[model samples]
Target: MAAGLEARGRTATQVRLRRRFLRFVRVRPGERVLEVGCGTGVVVRDLVGLVGRRGEVVGVDASRLMLGKARTLCRESARRTRLTLRVADGARLPFAAGRFDAALAITVILHVIDPMLVVREMARVTRPGGRVGLQDQDFGVVAVTHPERELTDRILHGVAAHIYPEPHSGRRLPGLLRAAGLEGVRLQTDVFQDTTLEPWTKTFLERRGERAVRFGIVDAATARRWLDGFTHLVAQGAFVLTINYYGAVGTKSR
Candidate 1:
């Protein structure tokens, strides 16, 4: 989590997610872009390359710590690509209306206090006919290979969603765009399925189960067993997992 979350680097899974997100947005060269809650600026670095030299991309986040990391990761290219890193709240972006040709909140909505206000702000800050995009996972759709299917279900739908606010954000994105008065809303999904039990995909169970124990959703002993089950399943070469992420984009009314 630390490596991918703070390093402005993509995990193998996130690399695939990024491709799907960019496909939905279809940004053009020389277009000004805004990415709210830009994390550590992994996507911002991509946007910098997408918009090329003439254009600029602003990456803003509510966390100064994240912005600081983003600034450091993007420093080499920021000067050439005209990237800007700032601390700003998504619900109230610090930019004038219609200031950008495109705006996006990639994997950021679920963590926001008000996804609705953030989307509205995204729409408001983009120019007429400009683009708006969002990408998030529906943790509700998680599946893991385990003998206790019922426990797995609880861990995914109840525990994971409990720990992460708006874990089902991916499912709500299309309606959100429409509610914001954006037109021609489009959506695409990227499914993450793995057999190797990568930490990013598999250890999520341990983390969720541990928190579930703390929250009393599951007992500490049960959480331990679940984590232990992961190792056993992997050793037997029977481990498999899947999660779905949705990418959505729309055009602001001209």
Candidate 2:
């Protein structure tokens, strides 16, 4: 599995976006929240604050490396006492029925083999009348200002398939939610734009490009070309990349 996008400085953006995403769900204090694939605990920290000190936040991921980072981040937070980090698969969550008030699976289903199974598990673990939420980017909706949009999409999607199967999984979220037997399932979309390309290019190269090269997905030269193209697009004020993230929330029937 590929290392999560959350690295040292990159967490700030994720934290900000997650806060906004969670706002849609109206997360409350003192709730038992389960975060599936809580990479590096960035979302976990945000959830801890939202749920307050009286709440419990349990973060689960299949990657121990991610869990290690999450554990470390949890320990450094003010609500550390309210947090728990564990390693578990989304398809088979290791918890009793109706164990949580809410469950969130962020940017993780696309990487899993069977997103429906994960959604079922999320619904199963959530208590009656509780919420089960999922957030994921629609790869088909990703738009870039580059001239080679098709090529870029192909390469990017190819990389995703190699690194994480089912890269464009958000398109199926609604159907999956229904299959999971949840009620009142709703889907909302959000867009994020980069104001400047320099920072975006630098961050992408440093984080994603480096990982691509390390994983032998792309050669260093190819990575450099990708960065250069991004830089050019940014210089022309045409460096616009929009990702339509689909978020679904539903209630578990009693």
Candidate 3:
């Protein structure tokens, strides 16, 4: 996993988002759940708790670094016994058919090159009538609080295009789920609107900004420019960054 992603594992928003996403999942005790792209086991820890002693939570990620981190976290959890972590790819899950009651891929579908394959894989692993849930943010729906909307959009798109070649995957999730032969697909959106930019600015500058530098994605100059623009927007007191995250759940055919 990228160092930036490791850093993201420790962010407050990331933690909160993971918890909220789990709540959205409504995992019950004694149920088997697979969490795709379970980076750093942040969500996996929550899943373990939700599943209780009788249930099991299997977490899979393609990144060895992330799996290492997840293993460390899992080891520290008291509920570790109920959790399992694997280094696997979402596009090709290494599980037998109908192995899980439900599956969730939080903020991971966007990274997949062939999202349909992932959807099919998740459906294949889940039992009939089982639910498969996917959650991701749409860049087009993201509300920027920065003063320079144009610049922010430009930077965001530029970086996203480079980091994630297919940034449009999130937009196609609903259709992909339908195409995967899942039924009763339902899509819902959640918005996190904050008037103060301090949290987000700090999140970006401290974590994302540093990651950009570490990964050589953006130079110090560009990072500084982005931060400066964000600071100015925060000072204006009219800053409100609204994140539009959508979640869709479908049941495999019986």
lDDT of 1 by residue, 1-254 (tens): 43556322445766767866886798888999999988788888889888999998999999898888888888987877778899999999999999999999888888866788999999999999999999887888877888788887776677766666788888999999999999999999888777877756555666788788877888888878877887898899999887888889999998
Best by TM-score: 1
Clashing pairs in 1: none
The lowest-lDDT stretch of 10 consecutive residues in candidate 2 is 1-10
- What does the lDDT come to for candidate 3? 0.76
Q: What lDDT score is found at residue 231 in candidate 3?
A: 71
Every model's TM-score: 0.93, 0.86, 0.85
Task: Give candidate 3 regions above 4 Å deviation.
Answer: 1-17, 78-81, 198-201, 205-223
Name every residue pair that clashes in candidate 2. Answer: none
**What lDDT tens digits, residue by residue, belong to model 3 across residues 1-254?**
44455555565666676667667666788999999998887678778878888998899999988888788878856354467789999989999999999999987887778788888999999999988989887766666766666756656665566666456565667788899999998877776566666444356544555556666667888777777776777787866777677778888999
User: Clash number for every model?
Assistant: 0, 0, 0
lDDT measured at residue 247 in model 2 versus the true structure, 0 to 100: 84
